[model samples]
Target: MFKKLKITCDEATTICDKNQYGEATLLEKIKLNIHFIRCKICFKYTKQNMTLTKIYKGHAKSCKELKHCLSDTDKEVLKEKLNSFKV
Candidate 1:
């Protein structure tokens, strides 16, 4: 019963990721929802994950119409940005 449903935060996070990609089973979803009952932090994490996925899906659809590669100038700018980020 309760013992079967009980999951650690790590397992909960994994299940949450699986759920994002539609890989989680119905039982896993049930267990995760049960986990949310007592764990606010994991619940918050799932909410944030869902939000990010939603945003990414919308952005990806728009990006499909855009170019697939950067130009020489664009590559140079990106290289400069990366070099600036390095110590």
Candidate 2:
């Protein structure tokens, strides 16, 4: 029954993280899905985890396509500003 398939919140979170990395087994995923049916907090955590993963992936992909480098003058100005902030 569903009771037999239930997993603890800690285990669920671990499995959720593994699933994010494509490392979870089919049985672990099944248990996680079953756990999600009854635990709103775990469900929310999984949703947020997926959102963060997507955001990070998007940022990483975009970063590869964009290049930003400071000129020597800009670097000198930054160094002076940083020096002024020193104790």
Off by over 4 Å in 1: 67-87
Candidate 1 weakest lDDT stretch, 10 residues: 63-72
Q: Write the per-residue lDDT of candidate 1 for residues 6-68, one digit (tens) a residue.
A: 999999999999999999999999999999999999999999999999999999899997878
Estimate the Cα RMSD of every predicted model relative to the unseen true structure.
8.1, 6.1
Candidate 1: count of backbone clashes, pairs at least 3 residues apart or interchain: 0
Error of 2 at 15 (Å): 0.7
Please name the candidate that would achieve the greatest TM-score relative to the true structure.
1
| Minimal lDDT window, size 10, model 2 | 1-10
**Residue 87 lDDT (model 2):** 42
- At residue 17, candidate 2 shows an lDDT of 93
Candidate 1 similarity to native, TM-score: 0.68
TM-score of candidate 2 relative to the true fold: 0.63
Can you give the TM-score per candidate against the true fold?
A: 0.68, 0.63
